[model samples]
Target: MEKSGLAEFKVEIVESCLVQPCLPDSPRSTLYLSNLDNQPLVRMAFNTLLVYEACENVLPHPAKTIREALSKVLVYYYPLAGRLRKKEDGKLQVECTGEGVLFVEAMVDNSLSVLGDLDQLKPSFKQLLFRFPFDNALEDVHPMVLQVNHFTCGGFVVAVSFNHCVCDGRGVSHFLKSLGEMVRGHVKPSLEPIWDRELLKPRNILVHDLVSNEEKIECKPHSWTPPVYKESIQMSLILDFETLKYVKDGIMPKCFDICTTFEIVAALIWQARTKVLEIPHTESVSISFAVDVRRSFSPPLPNGYNGNCIVAACAKAIVQDVITQPLSYLVNIIKKTKMSLTNKYIRSIIDTDQFPLDVHSNQANIILTDWRWLGFSDVDFGSGSPVNICPMHWNENGINASNGFIFLHSPERKDNGIKVIMWMPSQEFNLFEIEIESIIRKYVIKGSKF
Candidate 1:
């Protein structure tokens, strides 16, 4: 199973689907960014591209085929563009180029040993991916950055960088599924893409009237920041469903029958992280989650409508208080925060005139994103689907914090439990490991074979 062999297969798939007949040009469209505040909107416009490979029979071929497949995929996304505008009332509106979209690639390297231990791979991949340099290449024709020389031992890595405004995780998954279909010989996508940007139009020209018009926006004049930490961060342990459920159930007694896996785990992590970081009680920390708004669209976005359909929900608390609080309290905080996510909130965040540019940057230390319910395992790329599909990094907008976590459902595992993937600074991670193991040991009960 050499990289070249896999490369050949990749080429065959791309040629049969893309190169032979040439892809049809996507319709011209534009996204209106003027509605969105500068910093968060720009952050939303950038996306991450991921490459997954089996340790056995790594792709073998001239990097050309892989690169070609990438180019072809971009062709499919090209028609999508974004627009930034301010209305007469100074309301910011984000309009998508419904005609098409754009994407960027993020790359990383892994080892056979890392794959052998899923837990280690999870965090290691995240840390490596956050260091990806796509933003530095924003001015390039492709607006894509390559993360080469990642995942070096007993395997190879694939890099992808995409524009954030074009799509969210679900939308990106749709595109990947389409790419897999093309690779597997589906000339016509089973799921036809739906591109009606008009549907996303805001009802009022001035959506969020509360945001002050005088707030100033700020952003890094340039993309590309040095890695947050110099030391290499390795993946930790994988918490199986049985263990996770045990912990969740144990905490449920305190939560009064209301709490999601995300809230509980988030509380646990936040507590541990604050302790490890040794932050003062007065320090404010928050947990930001991404909320998909496709369902909120007037008619609900069509099944294959690919573009950004997400918003952020932040739950803030004092550093010391969050750590000492009961799981139930944290659950309530999360629920209340989620309830506040509305079209108005989305518009408010997008309305640069209302919200200050610094709002997005002043978020909490811990960020959580849940893909457990996203049904990623159903994404079959023709080769028996993925046993696992985890995000390689957390660099997307609000989630790219030094301490970030993503929740994923293991492919077809009967345990019905979710896997928690976390990344943090090496020192913080070590402290986290100690706290997590202690919590599990104290609160979790082992289950039958799962």
Candidate 2:
């Protein structure tokens, strides 16, 4: 049975087919992916949701225009139309088959209001995105897939799923911007697509080992099995600029250099989460995140360079120290670890044979990533910019066992501050909330709430 009121909704697919490139003579050869792209951490596919509200001028052809625009955009991002194949050495490469991507046209049973607030959403997998009919290996999968679901109120949602071997967050954002330009009647993308994947290949130099041995053992890139839990929930922590300013100002006097918003917030969460978990005092706790290395290059890679250009940045401390020390201590540790990611550090990780995946299976670890400045808000297809953009949490058959924190930039809804989305076991959520609130009150003000 469906939920009552605005929450009751359903999606039905009206059409599904392949959307090929408009150009006939796309490149027909194999393309080598970088070590960063081939690493075990980003070996799977991920999905993102872009929500658009009703617009009188663009209501009639929401799916038609996007389908046409995708065809044109694929001409430039040709690799996305191809498939991935694993080489003899176990590294994956693009086959450049130009087979095309899956595009689905769907319709919703109700208006956009049926979904309620996008900023604070629960997990729902009612076929908003296209799922492959048959199970297949990564090589047999389509490089990219998209679904556009039209609502009764003239609003629609664009859900995209793509393999990580082709591009990272920045690279995909660039592609969406180009596609949006095409939807608005631009013949060509504003920026030409660049596939210089070879530039990110590791140099033939001795690898610099920065991470500790404990991290290597814990974060080793191997097949992962999701841990079974009684129940889990998704929660959001909204910190506007004013709240952030107050928190940072209260703590800056005790730190070395002024800590960044990410650094401070990440540290706060790590502390709060660890306290709630009740881990042993002697055990080690780790926080891992991706650091963009695009600018770290001597001659920076062009804005259009579409490939993985980030490396794992990890910081670790004992549980006792983390729980007992001041928040500024963890902030300093994160700052130092992130600052250590120089061009040399990036090259060393790439050049090495075994680059460890930062996400450890250990229960005491925290994985955080920042998607606040990926240029998603600027993407306007014909109606206008999307009213909301967020990662869709789907747990069909428990295939998606992602347990981590994502930092989102909600300028309109969050008063130009940041929103942190967290997934964790329900049993500990109340305690975690209490811990976070206490920390905020202790540091920011007597009665402030996060």
Candidate 3:
């Protein structure tokens, strides 16, 4: 029996198998991955869980329907059904062997209500997804894995884990959308999948040589080291649109002409986290976020072209300025950093292979990625859209903590607010929360600026 924080329950796996492409003549050729896709930073598998409430009179079993839909969808996104292989040059490519991805049908003993708060990532949530206990390299296992766990209340959870090296958040959402389309009885996917990885190859003339090199950070080869934390936790913080607007209004007069909600909220959290960590005043701190470059290119990547199209955009400043400066000061730094992500700059990143090396080495760095715009909630699997979608948060060996921030939409969808989920050391989390509340009370509640 697995114990969720809210209750004790058991998840029994009923069936597990490889789901292959439905088409008999699916292509069996090798596909090259782009430089962005081959980066070491995104080598691991990422997991997410989608929750759907019980339907009144739906007849077909959810797992059967989803499995069939997945098989059909794999015909279009065939690379997902393939395995990742490494070349002599140390880059990754997909071997289209039609081996297919893993699919599991599971049954949970408890109802949706007994699962407790779906918003919080709990230990029992691990049971919702199939777990591999044995040590196996990524190339030795399936690239895409899905498990459909049916609750006693007739609801189900679609927990999926896919290789991040193949595609990014947007790309996965696009693939999921296609699977949903198949479940809804669509003969063909609304949008076709495109594979133009070669188009993003380094050009003849290097971009850095042609442009100013001041912004170019030294390129460093990424090395993945398993993390170990003494004590860690994940917490969620909600900030309503009203509160954000109030803070922005107070700071806009002191900062740039336009301030986005993301900029304002991110700046506040960065300031709070930096202050709580008590970083050295002389140390250099950075805030890194992903910026999509699909539309930034000259010809503009096609609509269906889903690959890793995001680049890390970073804002850097001394620790003293990050903590002591006004909130608007950090906001301006963030805004300016984002505005600097011009088309040429994005090209330079690919051509020079230079990414934000600071994010990996700097102890004071705070990394954030926004899921509010990722379109995960928009995927419908015949029982209507999922009520909630969240990451499957757990540490390897129960001691490793993923340190980062994610901006998610309000689960209830009743308000214009967003949820910021953060993972850090447990002791630091308390102090960080205090700093956040202090900022909110000072600025939004009392109409005072920091």
C-alpha lDDT values of all predictions:
0.50, 0.77, 0.78
Q: Please state the error at residue 376 of candidate 1 in Å.
A: 4.6
Q: lDDT winner among the candidates?
A: 3
Off by over 4 Å in 3: 1-5, 57-59, 133-135, 210-229, 356-358, 400-402, 446-450
TM-score of 2: 0.91
Tens-place lDDT per residue, model 2, 381-414, is 8777888777765454543333588898753663
lDDT of 1 by residue, 140-188 (tens): 2222333322344423343334455445567656665665565555655
- How far out, in Å, is residue 166 in model 3? 0.7
lDDT of 3 by residue, 1-450 (tens): 012247767899999999999998989999988878876567667788888888863426999998999999999988888999989888889999998889999999998876654545556667888766437765787878999999888898899988888888888888898998998899978987887788788787846443432233333332323234575656677788888887887888889768998999889888998887676676666788887778889989899887888777778777678888888998988888887777787777678766644455554577888988877888888777788777765655653244588888876673678888777666777778899888767677664545
Q: Which of the two, 1 or 3, has more TM-score? A: 3
In model 3, the worst 10-residue window by lDDT is 213-222
Candidate 3 versus the native: TM-score? Answer: 0.91
- Quote the lDDT for 264 in model 2: 87
